[model samples]
Target: MKLLFIRVSLFGILLFNGFSLKAQQVKPDDKYNRREEMITMRDGIKLHTVIFSPKGQTEKLPFLILRTPYGVNEYPSPEKQGYVKDMADDGYIFVFQDIRGRYLSEGKYAMMRFSRDKSNAKAIDEASDTYDTIDWLLKNIPDNNGRAGMYGISYDGWTTIIAALDPHPALKAVSEQATPSDMFMNDDLHHNGAFRLSYAFEYAFMEEISKTDSLYQFGNYDTYDWYLKLGPLSNMNKKYIHGKLPSWNDFTIHPNYDAYWKKQALKSRLDYPRLAIQHVSGWWDQEDMVGPQDAYKALEKKDTKNQNFIVLGPWRHGGWAGGDGRSLGNIKFEEPTATYFRKEIQAKWFAWYLKDKGDGKFAEVISFQTGSNKWKNYSAWPPKDVATKNIYFHSNGKLSFDKPSAKEAKPFDSYVSDPAKPVPYRARPIEETYGPGSRWYTWLTDDQRFVDSRPDVLTWKTDTLTQDVTITGDVIAKLYAATTGSDADWVVKLIDVYPENYKKEPKMSGYQLMIADDVFRGRFRKSFSTPEAITPNKVEVYTIDLHAADHVFKKGHKIMVQVQSTWFPIIDRNPQKYVPNIFEAKESDYQPATQKVYHSAQFASSIELPVAE
Candidate 1:
């Protein structure tokens, strides 16, 4: 009896230890079916990747890849996470990789490093990294069909595009969301030449800390108190410029759009190999305005497959992914549109590409037609039937399609812009951090009510139109103005005023969405790199090209145009001293400047609208 007891106890111990070992190797019954592994690049850099394969037994499956600076395990490791199980259960493989130099990946991380052209051939381009990863996975992973798709949001979006440019034949499709094509056009830095300070600093602050390749803890800025009370962007940097931050100093040092920015821009090189694509954007994403839209337009021009598609929703950032489709904040859409994007549009895109179920649902260009508040689809962007129109600024704050008469001679509105107290360009009276950092741009629609009241903002409006005027395509503003100061910034906002009695529920009462608005820092009139300040009080005609916009004004609604000298925080407060790269300018460079805008027939300031007939 003693010998039998000892044998039974020893057998139990062995069985328990074996079960623990197996559990460590693979969790039992994981829905996502996640597996962590490392893939070594050609140059010995090992990339950390978390892969999700189909649960249970399955045949060869389609693969989708997302390479992100943000960690892959943010939530449920993609596979086990909401709706992702559909892909896994439906026999699809999902892979999330930490980009080189980021967490769990080998090598030093550099900002915007993966997209640069390799003249010396020493660097690892995003394309090469993608190629190597795919090659390794196909050989090592079981049941892969040798076909893959790439999809990403923001930084990951950049890689998706870069991969498409020099793609592997096995890469069949790509879906890039809010990815910047040109780093300069509408990404992090300059828009038309204005310095995007607050947007740049906070973005870089988080990105810089994410590089430690370890766990990062972020302290709340307490938006209402700390960041807002910090006064100016310069002061915020002074307080937060601890040794850990990298991109902050780099951005502050290079205020002007110089080679530093040009090197990082994807526009310089956008030659994509043959691949189907779905590019996306939002009407209210002020920070990354030109990325997915620009990519869609460019790829359509160059791609031979004729397979480019775009979806612009009425949301901000990546709002379409996890949010409801209804209107946000003050701008109510009356329906839940975000649900359509995620459960429907996203799934359809993947199905069309991976499963070869081409439903033709998203084969066309999809954009939100505001004012009308409906979704419109076209074979291509701006459609083939659109037309262009020019609305001129007239005397006494009037705007009209008719050109100013030769007999008309009216002086322009003038005001003094003080850098110390620059006109607030960002939506005001709201929490300071709300506009740029939060979801405040929805209320900030095309409405110019707030800007029209500013002393530095010049308002020009037209009488209620007798007939409807529809506009489609790009918006170009020709400015005929001069300044008493050597340097100044000019902001142009093109607005569509609602009809006198146009009413919604009480919740969305005050929001009058603008059609389009843009700003240009004047010193870099000709070239972004070299800025030439204006001669004091000299009359000069500068062209402020606000990017493309699509809108239609009903008969009762009026059109308005506004020009302002400053838009604080959005664009850094220009010193008006004509200093080189306002980022490095000292306090002495800051000064008050007087600005004037002309509207006479001789100096006609007008907006050239691409009118859709």
Candidate 2:
């Protein structure tokens, strides 16, 4: 056998929460071993898997698996990453595999592979692939307990959920972090019914452009300019995509939340996971906040035995997968959240269920509430003691909890939404998604002041709060809106305005932080599947789900709301003219429109927030 050598750094890397690798070996001991194998699934196709066994383990250890479409060339080592260091110390038979058709794995890769028919004998899916791999590990690996656990972030997290659908007898625990539960509804592909262009396109270009991950080089430093120059969505095929990427093609065919999206939705197809499962999410998780939350809700319906668990922190998409979780953009979370979650929460979650080592006393829901910057534990998400309140939009740009009275002056505020110059989702010269120094991860937390003064973006704010107002649950935006065009997109944002002068953190002075926000494509106002053109210049009630959050508008700070029409690139520009398919829309289809939002008693626009008492 050929031996592989890795450079040793005698000066050890620091571990977390009082844990240290000071006594760790410069290199793995002789008893430690690594091997690569092609594990055969029930369908007879093989998947590439890499296994690592602990050095000189005293007893039998359970298997911890991570299956991913992203290349699984290297597994985490205690000497390097703090994310899995605790699990390493606990002595797991760590296994990582490239899922079907990805990297070295054999067979065709499906973007979000739908579950197979369980009644059929020859049925195969990611779940079956997992079952087959576990069967192989238990029989072939040495000194292993007959139990297994699976955990991963993002797409890997989705695969972990696949395992829970039709689990092998030995697969006893799962941890899914930042998983995309649905491609269309509230995950990566779309927010509500609006298409996510840059992400969906770039991600496909990388994932399916040749099997091994590839990157799309944007023509301009600012992708906003490149996308604008490309004109309509149809140019995507004419210029670059050109029928090669399967997912992009799928997007062109299925623009609505129709059968295609429903069939692939894991939230709808889920069965009660009988084994232990932990759902993790980040408050600012730009990618898949809807996923874990939706999955948790689906499982909650049948969780009589209490096997479901969830964690939410003030981090980005898979942000807690590494780093100290100190802060994002200009916001700081005094909580050492990522470290605590990995060391005390995620690691021990697998330990309790897989190894039976400790009492699984995890709270049903664990959340790191921002603004006040503290951690919360509850028997149920939203805590049940929460109250519902609406922050109403008032005349002359004011926000108040009190409802609008009949005596108020003007009924609404109006703005011009020009497709020619759509509002930039972030500060200008916006980098490509996943590009070097890209602020995409923390753009949601970016100071809203950039868009606050724009004529297209209208704002309403409240006076400085006299007391702490903590919001903790699903947030909904009710808009009484009118657009001059037949179609439009309504964007609503809930902001936390900082005091103008803060001596300690001078950078955050007068910061306008976004707490919860979402967009609703006007066509989907009635039904997501069957869209209808609006009667030009008529008012319509568009209710947008701003999603969930746990935040506080502390004393001396203000609560603000901003409404707008277009969020470019991130959300493909809505042509404002009704068309059968946005992907096939032409340049002539794009138009400028006057948008109005009402604050009258008859059509009071407001945000319904879940306030925790």
Candidate 3:
């Protein structure tokens, strides 16, 4: 966790971004004077902190702090070395801290430490530790303005958000980017009650196996094969981890959305501080996309002063924090979107609120609409005037706005979902998530045509659009599906099918771009906290949240939807058999089952789109 702060963030990504060939030539700046100190928390635990101010500073500057479970080295991190030169030039008392129990800090480490009970004075958590650190920084650090602003990416982003929940008087602004809100629901560990196999397992091993950073060595280059061959979830401990990783054990104990997860959820803390707030994320963020949006929506409800704001772009993880942002993988954007966010939005956001450098003006929501390659601003998310339109699935692999016809009774598409031969989420030879030459960063933008030929994966698409179809809000997938087994996992992907013979980019011709997607564990459909076996062969209504997006399917492009039972090792293969706890399921529980997607007038299956007015 501590290493992720520096390794999974700004500099780490910039180094790997082959797109930023131009950025690499520029020499890293090291003009700021750096000093390290051990700041004492309320519990007498000393936190590792580093402060950097301009070499020859005359005027006092507001402190911009980033608290991360990832270690902040004695010398400034690489991101501080180059990526934030703009902020450095603008003048800031930049401060970085390693949270308690992480590197250089004195205390036991905890993963995503939750908010503390305010009633208990000695109760220590990430929020309290941040408050105490700020309290100390104010008195100990010299040549600093009274005001402070907090911001970070990923884990640090989570810390930033928790700090704002119980903010201090001097904490004037917060920029929580890519922060996970609910671990068990739609972020990091699980998505709609389905375990994020590769990410969750690897992350727990990397963060918890030791105090410092560690990566679990895998034998196979294609991790999908490795995870599949590894067998049941129980083998994770018996074969390698052996009940050592805390989060892994937690995953087993709390298979359901139990009280344990409910208590620690930052989303439950809906009240936002009375300060300027900005929630930034990407539409294609493979992890934590729902987090920032969830937090932003919660803050919006209480934002009488219009302090809550959001920025949704076409990025992945910490992609927006650095790089040209002009493009990702094979997909290209209109301009250097990330650079614009940094120089225009992020820089100005803190400058205006902290230093009063600019007019206090910013959009309530800034969304980059894809396909059309344009940025749009709106007063409300899901844009208030948008109309809900349902596109139903047709028998001949077609997606139509009209309801299913009554001519055919019990109309449905059938397929055999074999656990032994699950459909790979992305192209094969998939490397370690963050390994060198890994496509994990840009997997979302990969062409979905790779799986179109698979027998088990059902593909349906609308005809070439006559005009632009702009969807600018939340998208829901209402599926009426039945299975021969008692339990299963449903994976839905909304796609944009490019017109063949596209002259602009021939290679991208016939490309199927995944716009929005998610997986839902059928057993937990009724209640996330409770599990109920499916009534086999009986159609069950499943409403899966495809999340929100702002995308445009241009004329000549087709809108497509793909439904499959398995997304490979990315999402653990649902056993298709009813078990008291999937984690403890025996090898016999795994089996192939028949899945049917109903498309009848009586039980119409469709994807709900919020077509912008």
Candidate 4:
């Protein structure tokens, strides 16, 4: 399901670039030619690859490659080969390849293939396959410069990072956009051990079960009702999958952060410093936002040459790849951020590295401020000059930075988390994740007011600020909570409350715009790899990483926090009871639990924000 959105996004980029090129009267030059061939890997597996180059040029040009599992026919037209028609005048050979076992390639397909031991002769991973392909291209491709560059988004982005792990001599600069760093920890599969139900299930059905790059049809249009009635996670197989999806089977067998999932993580191995790397992602990216950020942080530890950089925008998943990028949902960014990124940032990065055409001055970290609608460059991420501030949750639905007085009596709040009445991640009548009219792509930025009034959701907000308050780094929610059941799930949302006098729309008044949010499964609090039953009625600290962000809470605006147990249809219900494997839990395991959140001076439940001076 997530991959489908990525494919659509890439296609949109091609169309956008194609139209922009035509608008500028750029025509396909007769000097350029296109050809298709099968690139053989070290293990003799052949991958379908296409090459586009200048036909009659005497000077050799650099080669840029994009390897993807979404098939090489994504563009179809030779003019739209690289989706960089704007940079066609710079002159470089563009190469696109279908990953092994995806389309016209050979060998078995494995999701997030673990890096193999290079000493083993028969071991073939994406890194080895990429090294072989680059070696072949440098030797066989005509009129090619000694250097090569690799870049891609989403799944292809993952391949780009993998290729950089053990790059060939010819591989120089790499840009990995929205790369999935750790599926179980953050990315598409789960969020803090909470399984992404709609995304993971449908994605497995499409990629593993159907064996095709197509969306699975759901009988009902309202996926909210459909998934709710589906009952337990176990019914996915009993009703439709029938033990067919290998991914789903794996999900059930390894419910914890065991060796199987740990091996698939890429962050631990992102220490290569030989290649110049640029990590790109959106702050509001519906998928894989943590991937690029985490990958950059990991590489920074060993960035001897200071070659790793990060770029974050106010776009959704792959949103910077196309569109005007002026706004998402109702909020406006007040600029053509997408255009600036594509032309000034992205194209310039490639031109400087691949062509050596410019001074190559790029920031270590470039991020956009959402509320303020401006781009800011930093010498380092989470800027070293920032101060950490904790916002406490207070009584009577109030939020404050000051510590609660010891005189206060009621220092805790409680709510009922009913499994049968789980709160929807978005508004009611939720659309399918991958099909027509699906709102899954932009649900992150949806106005959060819908769930604010629900009794099960506890919301706290600060008084209208007299001055703007800006937060500029990672956001962490430190919650002291207890559940009556043996297992539980906690969801925390950071939102920006609009001023009531705003004239954009009547509904815009007091609109709660979600800034950052994430979920944490209680069983994995002690250790992700090991699960422990929650001692009922015991207050435990659960730290939920809402990832990174740069946003401003305007004067007269309010900073809001909403906490809940269940974000249904999106994340599978926890059953609120101890279960060995959620995917195997029965209907009998589903039970309601009373949840408590303590905000006393002893146990100050608060959100830590990195605030710049």
Tens-digit per-residue lDDT, 1-613, candidate 3: 1222223432343322212212222133655777789988787889988887776789888899988765667335223443455677789988888878877888988887766777888898887888888888889878888989999878877888888888888999999888888988888888999988999987777667666556677867889888988899998888877788888998899999998898767767768557888998888888788999988888888888889999999988878866778998789996898888888888899999889999888999998888788989999986898999999998989898989989744499989999999998899988887655778888899999899789999988998899999999999999999999999999999999889988889999999999999999999989998899998999999999999989999999999999999987789989999897899988899999999999999889999999976
lDDT score, residue 563, model 4?
Answer: 95
lDDT of each: 0.68, 0.85, 0.84, 0.82
TM-score result, candidate 3: 0.95
Which digits, one per residue and each the tens of the lDDT, describe model 4 over residues 1-613?
A: 1122222332332211112222112246544577788988888889889777865667888888888766664444334433465455567888888788777687778767888987898788888888888899988987787889988888888999999888998888998989989989998899999999988887766555432364556778888888988998888778776777788889988899998888888866776567899999888777788999999988888898979999999877777776678888777888988878877888888888888888999999998888899999998887788888999988888898987777646788999999999999998778777566677767888889898678899988999999988899999999999999999999999999999887766668888899989999999999999999999999999999998989999888999999999998879999889988988899999999999988888888899988876
Clash list (residue pairs), candidate 3? 2-69, 2-70, 2-71
Worst 10 residues of 2 by lDDT: 9-18
In terms of lDDT, the best-performing candidate is: 2
Q: Counting only residues 3 or more apart in sequence or on different chains, how many pairs clash (N, Cα, C under 3 Å) in candidate 4?
A: 0
**Winner of 1 and 3 under lDDT:** 3
In order of TM-score, best first, we have: 3, 2, 4, 1
Colliding residue pairs in candidate 2? none
Model 3 residue 211 CA deviation (Å) reads 1.6
Candidate 2 local lDDT, 184-290, one digit each (tens): 87889998889999889878877787666665777578999988887999988887767888999999999888999999998678878678889998888788888
lDDT of 1: 0.68
TM-scores vs. true structure, each candidate: 0.86, 0.95, 0.95, 0.94
Ranking by lDDT: 2, 3, 4, 1
Candidate 1 deviant stretches above 4 angstroms: 1-30, 77-91, 114-122, 210-244, 359-362, 407-409, 428-437, 440-447, 506-510
Runs with alpha carbons beyond 4 Å of true place in candidate 4: 1-32, 55-58, 77-83, 504-507
lDDT value, candidate 2, whole model: 0.85
**Model 1 weakest 10-residue run by lDDT:** 14-23
